[model samples]
Target: MSDVGALGDPALEDALTGLARRRTVLVASDLDGALAEFTRDPADTVPAPGAMLALRGLARLPGTSVAVVSGRDAATLAELTGVRPGDPVALVGSHGAESSVAGVTAQRLDDGQRALLDELTTTVAELIERHRGARLERKRAAVAVHTRGLSDDAEQAALEEAVGLGEGRDDVRVLRGKSVVELSVSHADKGSALLALARVVGAESVFYSGDDVTDEDAFRVLPAADGHVTVKVGDGGTAAEHRVPSVGALVVVVRRLLALRSDLAPGAR
Candidate 1:
C-alpha cells in the first residue's frame, strides 16, 4: 500500500494541474471511505475537516462541477453531508440508483421491482436476526446487510448468507463492500452515474476518488489519457491510477487542487 507520501509525487501533481486547466471538469468522490473515514455507526460518518468545504469551493469555480457519488440513499447522504436542496455540490446515491443532480430524475420502482425489493428486505431481515451483530439498511431500490461489528467468523457467515440471497435470481444485483453486502433491484452503478453527470455538466475531464470495491466501476470508466484523475483512498488492488493512503491524504489532494484551480483565475479564491 502506498503511504501518504504518494500525494507529493510529481506525476500526481502534474495530473491534478492538468485536470484543473480543463475547459470543463467534474470532481467527484465517494462519501464513506473517500471523503469521510468509516465510523462504527454509519450515521456518525462525516467528511474529514475541510474536505466538503474544498469540494464546495471547487464547485463554485467557473466551468467546474463537484459531486459526492456514494452507495448511500440520497436523502440520508444529503442530511449527513449537510448539503441543502439546490446546493452546487451534486449528490448521487444508492450506487447511482438515486440522485440529487438537477437534470437527473430520481429512480422509481415498478410494481414488479418493488415486489422483489420487499421480498428481499424480509429475507434479509430474517438473516440479520439470526446473526447477532448484523444490521439491515433499506434504500429506495436496495437493502444493505452490514456486519461492521461482527467477529471475523460471524462477519464471514453473515456476508455469505447475504450473498446467498441473490443466488439464482437474475433480477437481483448483489454488491459486496467492506463488511457489507448490498442487494439492489436496479443495475445503475457509479460508472453510469459519473458518465451521466459528466455529460450533463459538459465536463471535458474528471477527478474521481473512492475506497471501496464498488468504486472500481467508476475507476475503470475514467480514461487517464484524457487528463481524468482517479484515486484509491486505502490499501487494496484498484483500477484507479493514483492512490492516497487515507481520507486525510485525500483531503490534502482536494485542497491542493482547489488552490491550483483558484490560482488559474484572479480573484476566484
Candidate 2:
C-alpha cells in the first residue's frame, strides 16, 4: 500500500497487475454509491467525475471481466448501467437471489418464507404510506424500508418496524445500510457472492469494491492469496485490506486496472 492515501492505495495495482495474467478476470462492484449515485438527473446518475469512463475503460481491458453486484434488481441494474441482458458482464442482483451469469443459483424462498415476505411487505407498505416521504422498495425475495428524505422519527420508526417484521426468522437476516433497512432471505452473503464469482472467472487475483454495511460480507471473505485487494469506500469498520474515501477514488483504481490488462482479444474485458 504505497502513497495512494484514503482514496486508494498502491496495493490495488499490485493485485490488478496479477489479475491481468488470468484467462479471465472478474471484477465485482456495487452499483449505487459505487458505480453511480442516486439522483434525479439522468446524466449525473453515474459516479461523479470520470467514474463512468474509468469503469468503461476497465471493461475494455482484454481478458478482464466485470460484474455489477448490487442490491437493486437485475432489470434496474441493466437499465441504469446500460448493460444489456446476456452481456458479458455478470450481475448479482436482489442480494443473491439472482445472478446474470449462467450456472449460478441463488437461494429460493419456500412457501412459508413467501408468506412472511408478503406480511412484511404489506406491513411496511401500509405504515410507510402514511408518511409523505417514505418509499417501499419491494424486491420480492428481499424487502427494503426506505426513509428517503423523511424526518428522523420516520427513519427510526422504519428501523423499528423492520426489526419487528424480522422477528423469529433465524433464516432471514436484516442488514442496515447507510439509509435503508434491508431484509433479505439468507441465501448468500456478499462474501459468498465473491467466492462464487471468482470461480467463474477463474481469477487468480481478486479486487472487490463496495460501500455500506453489506459490503463487509465480501471484504471479510477475500481469499488469502497475496494478490487479493479488498477496497472499502467511505467510513466504516470493514474487513477490507484497503480503504478508499469515496466512489471517485474507486474510478482511479479502475483506470489502473485498464492499464494493467494484458494482450488478448477485443471485447473480452
Candidate 3:
C-alpha cells in the first residue's frame, strides 16, 4: 500500500528495471481502464496507442509471459485485444472465471448455476427498467448492474437494490466495483487467476497493473518482494504499492519497461 508516486520515482524505476532482468517474470494487467480507456459502452473500449505493442514486446523477452485479466468473457477479451490462438499473451476473463491461452474457453455452468444466473439477470433487468441511466451487462457466469450515468442517489439506490436481490442466494457471489454491482455464479477471482497463470508460466516474479476494485484481488495476491511490482493506474484507495495518474500514463510505463527489457536482453550492445 505504499504510494510510490508516478513511474519516475527512482526506486520504482529501479525495481521495474531489475524485474525486467529476472530469469522468469510474468506481466499481467486489467484490460479496461488499465490498458485501455473506459468507455460508457464497454464494447467501444480500445487499447491506448501502442499499449498492445508494448505488451507484445514484453512477451517476446526471454523468460517473460504476459496476460490480460478482465471481467469480459474470453471470446470478447480476445476479440477486443486482437489476440488470437497461439499468441503469447494469455486471457483471463469474467474476473478469472474463464480463461483463454492458445484458444478461447469458458467455464461450464451447471444446471443450478444456470438457474441462479437466469434469476439474477431477470432481477437486474427489472432494476434497470425502473431506473434511468442504469444498464445491465450479462456475462458468461455473472450479471452486472452498471450505474455510471445515473445521479448519485439513483446510483446508490440501484446498487443497493441489486445487492438486495442477491441477499439470500448462496449460489451467487456479489461484487461491488467503481460504479457497478455484479452477481457471479462462479467463485473465481483475480487472485486465483493471477496465481494460476504464474504457476503455469513458472514465473519467479509478477508485475501487475490494474485500476478497479476487482483489481485489488490481484494486487493482494502478489508477493511482497522486489521482483513483484503492483501498480494502481488511477486514483482511489488500493492495495498496490505504486500509482500512475491515468491509462495514458500506464502506457508510458509499459513502453519504458519494454525499452528496459530491450536494453537488458542478451547480446544487446
> Cα lDDT of all candidates, in order?
0.89, 0.69, 0.85
Summarize candidate 2's per-residue lDDT along 142-238 as a digit string, tens digits. 7787765667887787777776776677966787876678777655677787778778766655677888788888877785365677777777677
Ranking by lDDT: 1, 3, 2
- Residues 28-108 of candidate 3 have per-residue lDDT tens digits of 899988999987777788999999999998898888889999988888899899999989888899998887753333568
* lDDT for residue 19 in candidate 2, whole number 0-100: 63
lDDT at position 87, candidate 2: 62
Candidate 1 on 117-229: residue-level lDDT in tens? 99999999999899998999998889999989789999999999999999678999999899999999998999989998899889999999999999999999997976789
Q: By the lDDT metric, which is better: model 2 or model 3?
A: 3
Q: What TM-score, to 2 decimals, does candidate 2 have?
A: 0.84
Model 1's alpha-carbon lDDT is 0.89
Which candidate order results from sorting by TM-score in descending order? Answer: 1, 3, 2
Worst 10 residues of 2 by lDDT: 1-10
Using all chains and alpha carbons, the TM-scores for the candidates as numbered come to 0.96, 0.84, 0.93
For candidate 1, give the lDDT of residue 269.
48
TM-score of 3: 0.93
Worst 10 residues of 1 by lDDT: 1-10
| Best candidate, lDDT | 1
lDDT of 2: 0.69
Which structure among the candidates has the greatest TM-score? 1
